[model samples]
Target: MRAVVYDAPGAFSVREVPVPEPGPGEVRLAVEMAGMCGTDVHIDAGGFFSRYPLTPGHEIVGRVDALGDGVTSLARGEPVVADNTVLCGHCAPCRRGEPLFCANFYSLGVNGPGGFADCVVVRAEKCFAAGDLDLGTAVMAEPTACVVHGLDVLDLRPGADVLVFGAGPTGLVLAQLLAHGGAARVTVAAPTARKLDLARSYGTDVTVEIDRSDPARALPVLRAAAPDGYDVVVDATGAASVVEICLGLVRDGGTFFVYGMADEQLSVPLHPYEVFRRELTIKGSFAQTHCFERSLALLRSGRVRTDGLVTHEFALGDYGLALEATRSDRSCVKAAVVP
Candidate 1:
């Protein structure tokens, strides 16, 4: 087997390694494709709870190569998506029906060996049948699951006017989810015209191309679109400055959802008086929990499209290049590694 191994932070290499075997209740998957995103970039920099000497790919789709003892629900050669998150059922959060906040959280690729290899083993229950979805689309299951969880947290109301910031893969997906999930009109704001153009096809009713460094310059344009402000404002850009701007766009008594992953040390000023006077609601959503199946179902049903979302693909040996592309390549929306 071949794998991209991270021996330490800011260090990695692709090398041949012995194939791993599955234990009881687990199955070994022959890696087909693994999706790379900003999270991978963070992991490469040694943040995001990443464990060293790890194979860093969390969004994965592969074929069942071998099954371990007691695993009869799946068979060899079946295509499936991996749910890299492993939760301890006995944890306080798990017992409270909040597995996302599990006290003992272990996510592959983040804190363990993952799918950035020719082969990897995961619990059989974590494997979701990809059905007939192509590798490109199936590999999106993890991200879509995160979007699903975000929507779940938002609990959006039907016919509400929505505004989303950022047009990245997750941002576009979240926009589509908001568009179809119940928002009467969904608007996307981003600095890139190309991504804004793509968002139009994914159920975005309006697209605003704002200058990232001077977002306020476009406020007049945005206000012209929604003079009363949006019923729900979301920041999917993960930039604290962007989030700060987005918070001011929420209508009175409306909700503001934070769906982007920002720097841990970053802080944004918030006026508690404004929130109190307006009776506003603020929410945040992290990585998913119990949403993988729904994401796959949405992809399979064509309700949530993945077209043009995966703009780049790389080979296993070019894992470093893939990470770099994901980190700095504005041309690359989503990068996939075909191991």
Candidate 2:
């Protein structure tokens, strides 16, 4: 089997590796497609600590090639996607139904071998069937699960106005979910006009191009577009500065959601006075858990546009090229590797 191995930070190589077999309660998948994510870039750049010589790809989808003992719900040749979070069911958080916060929670691609290979093994319990969807879209199950987490945490009412920061894949997907959830108005702010255009195509009601030098300028523009400040503001940029700006843009008593992973320590001016006066609620959403199945259902139902999100594709052997393209291609939304 050919696999892309992360030798170390800023280093990766494609090499022929021995094929892996499924262990008990596990299933081996012949990977059809794997999505290259921002986290992959971070891992490559040493932004996140990863085991050296790792296989780094989590947004994966494939057909079951073999199943180990005790795996009965899935059959060979079944198309599926697996939940990224690898949790210990006996952990305190898992016992409380919050596996995302499990004390022993780890993830594929980060803490274990992932799908940047010809075949990958996953727990049968984590796999969800992706009925009748193309491999390209099926690979989006992981990201969509993250979006589902954000949406679930927000709990916004229908017709609520939304302001989303960043027009990257996640932001665009979030916009679509907000629209599907009946948001009356959704504004997407991004520094890139191309991504803003893409967000609009995905149903963002308004798009604002923020000049990098004047990011704060977008706030007033967004407020004017929404008129009542935004009912809900989501910061997906993962930049501390942007998160600080979002705190001021949400309306009184409205909610602010932070769904991005910051690379550095974040320092923001506190507004305890305003927080007390407005009764605003600010929250953060992390990795997916218990949402992977719903995300697959969304794809199976053909409700949200996932195919268009794949702007680039590469062969498994061209892993380096794929990572380079993801880092440099401003117009690319999501890139996938097919094995």
Best by TM-score: 1
Residues 86-167, candidate 2: write the lDDT tens digits.
Answer: 8889988899888778888678887688999999999999888885778768888899899998889888799898888887
Best by lDDT: 1
Angstrom error at residue 119, model 1? 1.0
- Candidate 1's TM-score reads 0.97
For every candidate in turn, the CA RMSD to the true structure comes to: 1.1, 1.8
Off by over 4 Å in 2: none
TM-score for each of the candidates: 0.97, 0.94
In order, what lDDT does every prediction score? 0.91, 0.84
In TM-score terms, candidate 2 sits at 0.94
Model 1 ranges off by over 4 Å: none
Whole-model lDDT, model 2: 0.84
